[model samples]
Target: MNDWTSGYVAEIGYTYDFFHAMTPTRMGLAALSKGVQHPFGRETFSYCELGCGQGFTANVIAAANPHIDVHAMDFNPAHIAEARALAEQGGVQNVHFYERSFADFAGSPGLPSEFDVIALHGILSWVSRDNQRLVYDFIAKHLKPGGVVYASFNTQPGWAAAMPMRRILTDHAERGTGPLEKRIDDAIAFAETLRKSGADFFANNPDQVTRLTKMRAMPRNYLAHEFFNKDWTPFHFADVAADMGQAKLDYLGAANLLDQMDELCMSKAQLEILDNECDQVRRESLRDVMLNEQFRADLFVKGGVPFTERGAVGAWFATPFALARRYSTGPVKMTWRGLEVDMAGLDYDPVLQKLSEGPATVRDLLAQGLFGAMQWADITRMMKYLVGAGFIVPCLPLDGIAERSEGCRQFNLAVCKQSEETQKLSFLASPVTGGGVAVDRMEQLFLLARSEGHETPESWALFAWQILAPQGQRLEQDGKVLETAEENIAVLQVRAQSFAARRVRILEQLGISLQPIATAQEASVASSAAA
Candidate 1:
């Protein structure tokens, strides 16, 4: 039988995952941070995602930003089916899903044209070169000038130390003869045996040992896609930039905010060594070498228009931001080379304290006494650092985003209802971020229960347990699978106690948690008294 998958893994699907980097709103901020004005045209805009696995990111983005028309495509029929079901569940009419390869989509008459934003979560590193060209062709013909592209892939130097081991694991996987899952397991176990037997390669590369150990603990399904794919390759930053330049695109910056910080990008000594390199691509390539960066998330623009310092600062300062979650009441700390890097003495306290109260534009943060004397450049750097540290997140200003919930509610409800059958419903749409966040199985269940009038966490937990019990499922805690009814309930009660500690607040911040309504009598009395 001739295989049409073209070296792609078709037997098992990609993870039902949502990556935050795929959102256009986030891309806009990322571009602004780099001194470019992202083309978020007012009143109307369009976005597309190539290889949108299970369509989680696409659907959620559509549901959240109802004004933006969104489109998503994946070659897997199963993935497309799930994406469509999800869009239907979310009542997300603004988005369209197509089950077609890049080639087919490129050829199809129904394909979208002039998209303002085109993104790929992990396509360049996974697909054949032919498919990659097809992707470039799609972008070349369809992307509008000033359009932004978000693409992520495995990169060189980071994957260099482990290439030999990856080859061994994949070679074993290709030689095995059972289901894809079994083959992946055999490959991992084989790698473990080599490590235990004092393999010379393991001895020479201590980092590879760390890599294999982490691999052993990773989910087999994720490993199947990561190692077993037939067309796995890593690129240097220069190579990717050159390849993308074919489509008249320019590199903006990394999707992960942390990469923006040169201090974090390399050791102090390394930065000093490469400080004189003026070429942007070469600078990034050198940084990649220092960190052994295995994976990268980057943004590109179809026709990038330069912004003057004044214009860039105006655009950047006008953007509002909010605390992604309530911060811990202490200094944010990071560890590097066995030493802790604390921001307490750096004067970030008052800024975070103000953001915690509500969303604040850069102007709002700077106008305060603590930051008033600081330059816009200095203040922006601190905010980006906070975003990189996960202490804060970029949010859509409340004024810009219209209030709408029908699509998000429907989509989240579909997700909750699906959790009744499978626990892979791991994310929910976030209106505030115009993206999705990781909402674990337990929290998903609780949210669903609450929507149905399960008053408290205990009631919600019990309600979720009743659904699981019918399917011969039980909760697990501390690696212990609770088989008995009493044990499961006990575990859920404990989980319930802590769920409110953080998850409730997070849900409220994301605008997903339903609010209590006033009683009719109260409303009537207030109306009558006013009259």
Candidate 2:
């Protein structure tokens, strides 16, 4: 193997927490689909991350969708081991981690074509050409009908700037004979000399120059791992489209949906000129306008599936208001549900209004509102209330609306509760703790019950009792211990009905089909038995 591939492999082995920070993206997608109607049943939804590394993204998805099974795999045995360990530590039971190469997966016999969504982040650019072909084939054979696959890779125009740097680093490595660290040091010295010579393209661009300078200042391992990757390839939009077509997948949308520059936004004359051009040319022209390089996240739908474009659901143009003038005072008058009200009087209205304009941090909202008295502590409570009310959402600021709409608070809470329950169940089933449920396990059970459907504190308490009843435990309420089977059945039935209603609403919102989990008669019998 080349030093570049060796270094890349070494880096993957050394950095165990690879892609953990990117977990929010997969989690956000799950949360966003909560109220949407999918053609597949909710429980049938599944996600697979190609080049999953240490399975950070897989763990996050499993945590978000306890009812849905997750599968994570990597060619590196060491990486898979680390991923499995992390999943076990996190008490995540929903994910099945495996050490298998793309080639092996492609050649495997009788593997079910089960995945609903396949994510390939930073994989296509780093893998060899044969591996890339295997990846495409795997997606083609494994992804279910109408499934969406997210593939992010390095793209052209941006790579125009990166290619020269790669060449410079490769030449420097060839001139040096030592450990990877010494070679990286020599490479950095060479880059600095070129920078001083002022004869390079990077030197002409201030941003690229700054980036190179900062990168050189980083650790030797970082430098060696990044610039010395052997199989790194940057492709154009047209080429990617053709590749996907070969794999029996059709481009549906961009994973970074907002970044897919709209032709409508261009001037009328420009739009008319581009209208005659091909899709590839239009896409390239748009990317040029955005100055995007390094990464392009495209979504592909399975071929032979009827996927009608939803025509931008819930898209709104934000009317920019002068924050300095409009929100400079304390308790400004705001319109809410048609009536004007003091923004401070109602706990969540002000926060909701700010979010409506666009997403803002609690600090940003406070600063914009010119609130001199209330601190973040006071504002946090109101923000939580707004999140509970489904007015405002919380998200990691990666891509604008993609993260916001998808990272729904209620859905996150549900997934979190389910994760906790799964973890507790795993522990209870383990040989340790004398095969008895731990206190923490019981607490998580109650939390899961509440999040699954129960609304009131009393309902949560009742659900908890029902869960504990199977283990010969009862709840003490109002100085009395109630352990009746009928009471347990009543609580279970009510909670199930409530959850079913919520699930229906979520399906309607997401435009997904809702399939009944059980018939009415079966549900009644199950509820009666539990009671």
Candidate 3:
């Protein structure tokens, strides 16, 4: 039999996690922060995700934004099948799923000729060079003019210390027997033994010892795919920029967002070094080296049009923002790399207070003098900090809000129903944000119970226990598992009460409701058609 995986890990599926950065709303905001225009500013746009593992992000985005056309392709058939099933379950009609390799996808007919936004998450550093070239060629041919691309990959310098350790693990795994998971555990065990035995390599590199400790806590499935893959190469920023430049791509900014804020990430000396550098690519590479960046999520635009200073201010003013979650009037603590952001200390109380009343544009806040004595640049930077830290989120344009809400309602119902079987999915589609909100499995169960007319928190807790008890599951609190049904229900009721007090209002603003929008017959028809 021919090996079609091309040295990629195919024995196990990837984790069912959602990455919010891949959402169009987040991408558009990242672009706007750089004073550049994103493709999704208009009513409708097309998005494509290359190597969409599990397709969770694509499906959620499509469900949230009814106006966009989403196309996602992966080389794994199992991944495509699961994605299509979820889309059908949610009555999500706007997304197309394909199972094809990079070369095949590039040559496939009857697909969209061009896309407005293309995203690649955890793909570039894992695939072989030939496959990477095929991706570049695809972008060169199919990406529309002024389109944006989000590519995340493992970066150099930070990975330098662990490179040899990774080689050792891969080599050991290849020599071992039994299943891939078993081999992975054996390799990790061997590394641990080496560390305990005071091997020269482990002694020489202290980071690997720390990394091994963290690796032990990660899921075996993630380990198999992340390390066992044969073609893992971490690229420097300049090299990746050069590869993108081949396709007429200009390095726009980082989706990580904090990297753009020099004060937050760099020391004064490092800032002076970066400031003296003229070439952007070399500067980025040197900055990565200085920070020892292990991973990167970056944006690139084809034919990018940067806004003038006045135009940028206008764009920022017109954009609306809403609180991401409930906040108290205390120290709004958020940190990035030992950099503490005291929102309260920074006098963001007025802005947060105004947003709590309702979604407010910077223009509205300025008109009300909410920012006090802050200059235009200072206010914009403060807004960026809030958005990047997830304290606040940019809202979708109010136009067509009703339709988007309906679509998201149906999709969320399907997700809540799925929580009955598995709690792997931890996000719900939010039409207002045009993205996914982090709603845990228990929260989803509460939503489901409320939709079923369970009137109180105690009732919701009881309903959730009924579903989980049969599966031999119990609630975990402070890392301790609750054994008895009474224990579980008591803990759950407390959580449900907290959710009701804090989360409900935010969910309502996000256009979520605890009411089933799709009938059984409608779901049945959708399932049959998908089958």
Candidate 4:
């Protein structure tokens, strides 16, 4: 007999969170920020995700960008089934899910002949070396020219201290019997027992003890797939670059906009050293060392076209952007890598004030004289930091906004309906940004209520309470549970009011509708009355 999982976790499932970085619009923006030309301007393109667990991001991207065709595959039939069910329920078109391995997908006859973008997140370091090679081969064979590939993995130096802990857990779990979940719990308990017994490994590395404490609080499903896998290997940036080179893919940039800004993560001396490095691979390696990067979400392009300095700057300034959050006037602070950086002294107040009115490009701002005495370089840096910190986002091109809006509304409505049963789907498709927006379960319930003709926040709160009361769920305040029905409704009403005051405006600008969709019966009655 032979095992079919190939040493991967199959008893549990991956989380259903959406990754905005994997979306094409975000990838193109990151590439353009680095002065590289991407293929996103094409009228229509194909996208593929390898090892797409549950296919949440793929579904959201397809919904947000109706012009793009999406294909996603996973080896687990359960994952593929759930993905297909969600797509069907949402009435989403232009997306196809498959239950195929990396090797099988490379030779599959039913897939598109070529893809403009191939993306996989946190997949490389978790799979066996043979499977990783199959992924590379697939990209080499099917990725279109001038295409982009997004791959994320665990990095080496940052994981050096945690490697032994992972090995101990894997070894213990492999030796145990019965359900995999129980074995995982036993292995963690055993490690905790060792620590309590004054093991030298734990005594010498106090940080590992702290990490173990945090791990005790994390989801067991996440732990099972993340650490219990038989093949978990963290690689150096240079090695991964070489692997990508095998497929004729060149390192584009970090999928994260924040990672592109060196001052945020590096010191002056470190920056000087990195700036002096001529080779792209070597510089990226040194950068990882400087930041002690644990994981990386990187973009690579096949036969990339470099934009001239003038063209890059011109294109960036010409792109329109909108505020992602409520219009506020104050010093904006951001937390990165456990450090909170204050932007009070930065001259972003003027720009923020201008954007409060509506979406506009840098050129538009300049034409309005909002820059005053600031240089173009300073304005560019400000925009980069602001966008990277999530205060603002680039808007999608207006050419297909109507189509995107229709698809995203249907997908978001399906997600809102599903929120009653599960809170795992915490994002909604946005047509304006062409990406997913973080909208929590409670907010989703409120939105659904509004779409069902609940006019006021008070009514929205009552609708949500009715749903939660049956499930025996209550609101939590400062770690204390509000058990009474009145208490829950009060808290929910407060939240609904806040949502209506802030999130509603943002959603409207993103082309999301809060009005109800009339049923067929209602429409026919209205038609008869008119006649």
Candidate 5:
């Protein structure tokens, strides 16, 4: 490889995937929840993504939101080539893909001067120190005054356990001349041998056993980039915040929704761990120790003007989201950072019940006399928890979705067509949700079958089994993998019935069925028809 990579893996291209959490609307919601300024709620905006491998999210955002100017780049030309081709195939015109290094992008006069948002996901901790500084300089120069930077990276305390193993893997892989995948495979196998050999390193780093086990299941390309990167630095919250500070940015809040809810994430017992740390930064650092957070997805803002509590309430109410149809939200029983927190007492049922009626804003639910007793804070808190859990999703405004109508439809059709062939693309861009939706391989087959006039669930089951049986793959049920065609088809039959009734309708609704400006009453009627 060239000196440009500096031992970074470039031979293997990244996964063709979309991260829904990296959406601009989601970033806007997180900022709004904290009363920080954001540009995504505006009429028009420009967004950029650094290290946007395969550029799936950027292309989807541009297709779904006609108003946003999307620019994305990756150092790998192969990834950018595939990304650009996909955009062309999908007929997405607004998004532009570039294959450029950090230094070149930072100094380029041709790029946009200011951006509404800049996202760097899983790149900060995986690059050289010089490249990291160039990233900081890029943000400092190009981010608009009120822009938010969504940067996610591996973090300390949780990663401290596996740091030694990461070094061992990288060192072993670099010494070999084999294909990248084989090198990664052999390195992992060697690590397992070391673990079984009762080495003193394993005794000292007991977490390596679990890490190695889980690491084996990950894709080779993912492992190559993660562990084999020349520069892999897991940071502390305070240190990363300081790095952003050099760009005149402030730590806004977490882009990951669940991190926003303290009550759900931290137990009372775990909360006690921060008793001695009074400073905000120190408290956050100590909390990482309590939570053992291996990775962090954070948001920072440049010149963020704080909004009043009243302003935050109005923003929260006006922002729209559809019930994502992915989760059953009655009483929330979720365990985070070893804390099993249940919100059964919080009556989110009424709010969720209203959304099940149709896509509506927070204000819409309150105006209907639902959550009549709860104050804004109480309601917003529960909504935050719901949104974090993927039970709800942020949606584009009526005009935005309407203007991008054809672009959105064509893109989804192309994606669904591609999904029928490969499981690489597990998510579809949803104009209704203003983000990606998880659609597994079988579900994708079902959608294809439905469009092909296989309207019944049994037909969908047969179609999916045909795809699975040819590969010798079986249905996974209970804790075991079922091997027979009969066993697989039987399970797929039950799944298809529910999928056809609920999921197909949702697939249609997300593609374009649910209009943004429809009144709550109108949404209620539409909701009944869907059910």
Candidate 6:
């Protein structure tokens, strides 16, 4: 195993890039919305990313939520220098980058328990056991009450295959000559030699054989990071939970929603059989079915904070509410659980209609007549409904622009090659329907529409009207353009309503449940009529 100091110094850039690419903003928001407390306030929060390489994730969060002060730290000075440079280049001001190791910071005086969210992605498994203890101690001492910590690590079952591979590579590299690449080739050759040794683990399982073959083909850097490390210890889930408890933290949840590995994915019979088993062993058995015993993102919260009922905060935010507009786009489709809902059919049609465009701040949305005459509480409810149903993703930044859009694509790619996870989130926040539409071209369309003097809420809407006018005329049998503002507004209203309805349906199919919009009196009257 490699020493901690050398591992920290060697290829610090790669380590920084790996953690920086894991966006903690979305994870932080989800955890907060799910009842996690933040340091600043319930809605606002402070955060820090341990081992924050090049400060990429910190920069994005700082750009997204200027209100949230994000601190990024790494033991490696080179990594810190690169992160600071990246932050400056991006003009991100809210993040404070520090070049200090975890042990130094933990032992140093004057550190505050100021961070509401602490993220240690891919750090624990790589560090020495003593360093891991230091990390846990820091979390216990510094994390604010109700705060959440995001820690990811390698685990068993997955490591069962990975451990031997690592040993083989490390031994081979020690004996081989030439560069890292050539040594890696020699290491792979050793893995093949092991497979031919007639071992039951490799011979009996074709799936394992195929997996080993793929692992052998990975780059030397990957092999070094995975197998050559001196302190590479894979953990069991229950043991992890117990270890967290020992550190004055409680297991909150997992970062990957898909990897919950709960009763939902297990048959009732299987769950019943495991009911009597110990928590650690039970998780091991479940991982056997899930086939994901290797990598995990575990969320933990400080203990002693009173546990409130789940969904309490959600219910409070679900009342009708108003927020600013954040971005511009065309009609959007939202689905929930494979069912479509008509947003127009709901009482909040007018509001949802206004938000169908690309991302928009809550304040902007309200200012644009979407919540016309609606109570402030009602507007809050509507916004919460949209957020809960995933119609409008919560962007923490007051400006509503995605911090990690194509605008930053070049910078991100320059610093770190595109990964599947980063690509997917970027697509979700993109302005254009597919990949990305050029910003200048989109602006040109808006300008052209504005020059036409169409009385629409947004320039994009006017552009759509201009393109659709000829078709509308042909359908109406009148060569005359729809000249009346009221006529255009009425037509746009219907179109907007229809668009909202379709989007609502789609959102429902995607598992987002929106509340029916209605006042107390109106709901009573409708119910009476139905009865």
Per residue, candidate 3 scores C-alpha lDDT tens digits across 355-405 of 876677788999999989987778878888888888888888778877888
Q: Pick the candidate with the highest lDDT.
A: 3
Per-residue CA lDDT of candidate 1, range 83-106, in tens? 888777667889888888887886
The residue-by-residue lDDT of candidate 5 on 125-156, one tens digit each, is: 98988888989999999999999999999999
RMSD of each: 4.3, 16.6, 5.2, 4.4, 3.7, 14.1
Could you estimate the TM-score for every candidate? 0.91, 0.55, 0.95, 0.94, 0.91, 0.59
Count of clashing residue pairs in every prediction: 2, 9, 0, 0, 0, 53
Model 4 over residues 1-531: C-alpha lDDT tens digits? 026678889988988989878977788889988788887766789999998998999999898888888999999899999999999987788899989988787666679989999999999999999999999999999999899999999997888888988888889989999888889889889899989999999999898999888888888888988898878989999999999999999999999988988877677999999999999999988888887888999999999999998888787777778888875777778898777765544578777777776778888888888777887767777777888888888877778876787788888899899999889899899888888899999989987887776667788789999999999888899999999998999999899888777777676666665343334234223323322
Candidate No. with top TM-score: 3
Better of 2 and 5 by lDDT: 5
Residue 19 in model 1: lDDT: 83
- State the lDDT of candidate 6 residue by residue for 340-399, as single tens digits: 422332355555555443344455655677667876545544454454344444433323
Model 4 lDDT, full chain set: 0.84
Global Cα lDDT for candidate 2: 0.51
lDDT head-to-head 5 vs 6, winner: 5
Instruction: Give me the overall lDDT of model 3.
Output: 0.86
* Alpha carbon deviation, residue 224, candidate 2 (Å): 4.4
